[model samples]
Target: MKKILMQLKDYYGEYLLLIALAIVIGLIVGVVDAYFGMILLKITEIRSLSPFLWIPFLPLVGLFIVFMYQKYGKTSSQGMGLIFEVGQGENKVIPFRLIPFIIGGTWLTHLFGGSAGREGVAVQIGATVAHTLGNKLNLMKFQTLLIVIGMAAGFAGLFQTPIAATFFALEVMIAGKFIYPALIPALVASFVASTTSHFLGLEKFQVYLAEPFDFSLFHFLLLAIVGIIFGVVGSLFAKSLSILKSKMAMWFKNPYRRVFIIACGLSVLLLLLYQGRYAGLGTNLITASFSGQHIYSYDFILKLIFTVCTLAVGFQGGEVTPLFSIGATLGVVLANILHLPVTLFAALGYAAVFGSATNTLLAPILIGCEVFGFEHFPSFFIVCAFAYFFNFNQSIYGKQQILK
Candidate 1:
């Protein structure tokens, strides 16, 4: 007991320093996420106002985006891939330029009406900031822990869901592994960042959901069916994204021509189909799902296709927001079909689809509880569990590994 206490005493200073650094990370990342989220939302609103005017320029914007990356920020284009590499101990640095490149690229993609999401950009931004700080301070020995803390800060700042962000950062780097040591620092950073961003005017999307289903065997069975369906859709989304990215790369050969050509066709199709209904972050669909607005049976599938295609052609954005939108929209349809509460099922899909697509069960459950009410925690767990196991371990992030 004396020896253990001495050892703890010796290391306490280092641990305290790390905790202090986490506070700094949280504040910095929170500010960045707030600006990023606010601007992205503004961009989405701008595109919504005059879809035709902005969307027709998608091909030109795509060309510009490709040119910028190739010219000044080639390594930065790796985005989440670099974050994964650093976490996996395969690489040590994330280019500082990644911050500007991803944010700029995503803004342009949204401004010109591309179907995509913003969470990826936020995560990358957070990772880059933390990694840079760690490297400069010679904290490379704690690289994975720092990265996890940064991820949590970034995600929590944008979504204002600290617990979900903490677990997501902890578990997302490896399929079966959680960075236990990072838990304390990450949790602190997540809460701080979330509060900071909320203070900075980045709003969190939340809805109160009072569940109707008690934990009966019949309800469990019914939720299982819903979970299974969401899992299948999530897996399909991940698989389709991977295939499309590879196939498009092979077919185009030149990234410039690839993005431009695809963007041209995408521009026309986006214009033709509901006049850019499926464009941007799919937040519109998410809103429609929660509100009593009209959601067609096909809203989910169309959003899925558009989001997949947009990313496949090298558009800069995250898959997560669109995934949430896809899941929520699908949940509404599924609820109607299954004779369940539309809002409740929509909430379920909102969480489960994200869980399955990202292949992180804990994050989804926590996010569901955070965004909705904690009273639905049990339901979130059951649905997310079903979705996670049923997804076949597919992930939108190609670099994510299933630990053996």
Candidate 2:
């Protein structure tokens, strides 16, 4: 007891300060994320009402987006890469402009019917705010740790999934490696941010799965197979986006021309395909998947393609939400084929596909439980374990390093 008491006494000061800092970060980030997310949602609604009004101008908007980057973006154009570099100690600072640039760029992307997501922007916003504050406070040695706290706050604030956000911030920077040192601060930040955002009226997407089924050995095997499929789907998404980005860059050899021409082509296909069904964040597909509406078997593939092309051609947005939509829709198809409960598997896919793509394991499992119901955690755990193992180490964050 003396030894334990002495150790606690020795570390209490530092721990207490960290906890306080985390709370402050969470509160500030939560408000910022709430405002950003709510505006984006409103933009999505307006676009949904008349996709044709804005989608036709995608090419023009693409040119303007490209111009912004060319004129003043500098290292900011690196996007998530900048965050990874900072986390890895390869970079010391994240430019503050990254927050507004990404938020505005993503808003423009969705408004113009581009297929993309918002989490990436939210994360960048959180990291930039946290890192900047840390720098100002002269906590130079603790840069990476502070960034992790901010990242957790950002994700939790946006999704209202604190546990999942905590694990994601800890594990995402290095595949298969968790930063135990930052766990406490990350947890505190995530929970505080989640609560703040919820109170600020940022709605969370959740599906309470009520179907009951025994976890028989046969059921385990079936879920394992589904996990593998989701893993491969995630693998394909990361690989395709990376390859397409390179090919488009090579083919155009000019940023302005690339975004303009590709955006034109994308605009046509998006409008033609079910009258912009694959537009925005793929939320339509997500809604359809769980609402007992028609989810075409080809829906997932089209969303994946459109998202890849949209991002590859320089459209600004994140990939995570679309990935969730893809997984949910694909899960519906798999459930039909495998004769399983559609909603349950849809919930599973919503988490698993994201796990596979991000090369994250625990976050997806916890997210599944949090968003669905903890009662189904056994199923999510088994499926996510297999999905993580089978993801082939693919990640959407190219700058993320592999731990040796």
Candidate 3:
């Protein structure tokens, strides 16, 4: 008892310090996240109002964005790769320019009818702020912990799912190995950031499952099938993006020319495909999936294709929101085929596809419970388990380490 008491006394100050740091980080990052998110949404709305007018200029806009990177971005264009390197002890520094470059570039992309997501910018913003602050404070020993805290806060602020964000930051960088040492600080940061963003008027997406179904063996089999489909789709998305990115680089040696040419092609195809139906963040498809509106079976596939093209050709944004849209749309089709509840499976797909794409497990399950109701836990668990197991270890983050 005396030894335990002494140990607690010795570590109490450290714990208190970390906790305080987490609150500060969360508050600041959450505010920035709200600002970024709200602006991005505004850009999306502006683009939607006149997609044809802006989408035709995607090639020019892409060239300008590439030129900006070539001139001023330097190594900052590596974006998330640098964050992973620092987290993995590579002793790299993320350029402060990354914050503005990504935000501006993403805004341009969206404003010009690019199909992308915003969480990447939010995460980068949080990391940049937290990392800069930690360095200024000379908190060298806990840099990795601080970065994880920032990541958690960033995700929580945007999605308002603190538990899921905590798990995501803990498990995302290194698959199969949660960052146990930073769990407490990360959790604190996540909750604080979530609350701050909510108070700042950033809304979270949620759905309710009004119907209940018995979890019989037949239902289990059907869910497993759905999981397998989601897993395959997620894997395909990651793989296609990776391959296309590389191919685009190889095909066009210059960044400016590459973006210009590809964006031109994308502009034509995007307009031809239902007058930019696959443009922007894909929230329209997600909304349609849940609102009993028209959802063609091909919606998911087109979204996957367009999103892959958008990012491969130097468009800015995260793949997460698009993944959510794809999963939800696919879920609608699967539910129709399986004769299950549409909303329940749509919710499951929203989480499971994200899990499979990121090669994660717990984060998606928690997101399902958080975004959908906790009553859907059983179905979510069954589907996510199979999805994770069948993903074959593909991940959207190429730098993510697979821990065996």
Candidate 4:
């Protein structure tokens, strides 16, 4: 205990710095997330007011995203690939020029009814801030750790799951090895960021559930089965997106043409499925997941199709949020089939499938506990472990390396 206390005292200054940085990053991320959300909401409203006018122009939005990438997104290197590059010994600092491109491209994607998540945009912004700070301060390896911490901070600030965000930053890069030394900094940053976001009145995602029922043997078996199904669904989702991306690359020699093709395809599909549902980030579906209401048995399949196409088409966003929407809805459907509690199964599905898809175990379990409460911790851990192993090396971020 004395040794531990001394170590804590020694690292107190570093912890304080991380906390301060996290607060600033979190506030920035929170404002960006909220602002982007509001902007998307306005664009959505505009499309609603005149679908004929907006729908016809949707393909142009895709073209604009392609144009932005051709012009200014060269430094991004595509999606989270750039993050891995920085983490794995590349001095390829994220330029501030890429920030506007990411924010603008993502906003336009959603504005024109592209299906994607906001977390990707927020994360890139957070990392950019850290990278810029590191460059300006000329900090060494220790400062690079701040880049990772900033990722956790941004994610926590946006999602309001600080603990999960901490682990996510640690877990996202490699499997089987936790970066134990970074834990203190990551956690401190996450807490500061989450606190800052809350102070700024950004709301956390909410779920309604009855008390967790007793963990019966039968229920556990049933959940395990549901987890297995989720594993398959999640794996398929990841594989399909990868395949589509590859195929698109092969089909169009021009990157812009590939994006245009995807946009046009999505427009046609959206028109056919014109409920004005399953468009954009699918936040409505995530909200409905908790209630286990209004979700058809096939909702997951539809979401899977739309998300795969949207992401495969080269739009900017993270897969985790859409995965959450897919998992929760599927869990509800599975619960109904197995005669289990809808809310309980939905929560399990949300975490486990996300864990499976992302090749993350603890982060998703923590996410479950953070979002649903500690009472579900044991169940969440069990299900997520099952799903994670069952999926075995599959990942939504294809560039992630499996260490272990």
Best by TM-score: 1
Give each model a TM-score: 0.98, 0.97, 0.97, 0.91
RMSD of each: 1.1, 1.7, 1.4, 2.9
Cα lDDT, model 1, residue 318:
95
For residues 316-394, write the lDDT of model 2, one tens digit per residue: 9999999999999999999999999999999999999999999999999999999999999999999899988888989
Residue pairs in steric clash, candidate 2?
Answer: none
Local accuracy by lDDT, each model: 0.93, 0.91, 0.88, 0.75
Scored by Cα lDDT, where does model 4 land? 0.75
Order of candidates by lDDT, top first? 1, 2, 3, 4
Model 1, residue pairs in steric clash = none
Number of clashing pairs, model 2? 0
Per-residue error at 29 for model 1, in Å? 0.4
Error of 2 at 25 (Å): 0.7
- CA error at residue 125 for candidate 1, angstroms: 0.8
lDDT of 2: 0.91
Q: How far does residue 68 in candidate 3 sit from its true spot (Å)?
A: 1.3
Winner on lDDT between 2 and 3 is 2
Residue-wise C-alpha lDDT for candidate 4, range 73-155, written one tens digit per residue: 78774657776667656656677776788777777776677777777776777777777776776654554576677678778
